[model samples]
Target: MTRTTSALVVESAGAEPQLALVTLDSLRVNGVLVEMYVTGVCHTDLGCMEGYLPVQFPNVFGHEGAGVVLETGNGVTDL
Candidate 1:
């Protein structure tokens, strides 16, 4: 089953970030589900958000975060 979560989303280039409900697909093989405690929008992310970099929009805002691993899918052993 999939889960619903809240995230800061950018709908298009130069658009303001907004809080939205997003879906999480079932964990795939070797996938890890993290529950983020703190997330950040770094310069690289800002570049992508500002249209300075080529990226697809309707995108979630963050690549940097600290969190606990809630679930580990099959084939994961090094965590």
Candidate 2:
């Protein structure tokens, strides 16, 4: 089943970040779902928010993070 959660989203260039309700699809084949407890805001995330990166808006930021594995999809053997 799909799940909904709060996420930091960039809706437009040069706009402030906003908290948005996002829908997450169920785990796919060989996919894993992580419940992030701690996340870091880095230079890249700042760049993306400042339009320095050629990234699409309404995108989720913060690649540097640590989280627990909440679910694993089919054929996923490694944790």
Write model 1 residue lDDT over 1-79, tens digit each, in one string: 6989998899998999999999999998899999999998999999999999999989997888999999998878888
The CA lDDT of each predicted structure is 0.92, 0.88
> What does candidate 1 score on TM?
0.93
Off by over 4 Å in 1: none
Q: Model 2: what TM-score?
A: 0.89
Tell me the lDDT of model 2 at 56.
91
Residue 57 Cα positional deviation in candidate 2, in Å, after optimal superposition: 1.3
Instruction: Encode model 2's per-residue lDDT on 14-54: one tens digit a residue.
Output: 78878999999987989999999888989888888899889
lDDT of 1: 0.92
Which candidate has the highest lDDT of all?
1
Candidate 2: the clashing residue pairs are: none
Ten residues in a row with the worst lDDT in model 1?
70-79
Record all residue pairs in model 1 with backbone atoms less than 3 Å apart, i.e. clashing. Answer: none
- Residue 78, candidate 1: alpha-carbon lDDT: 82
Clashes of 1: 0
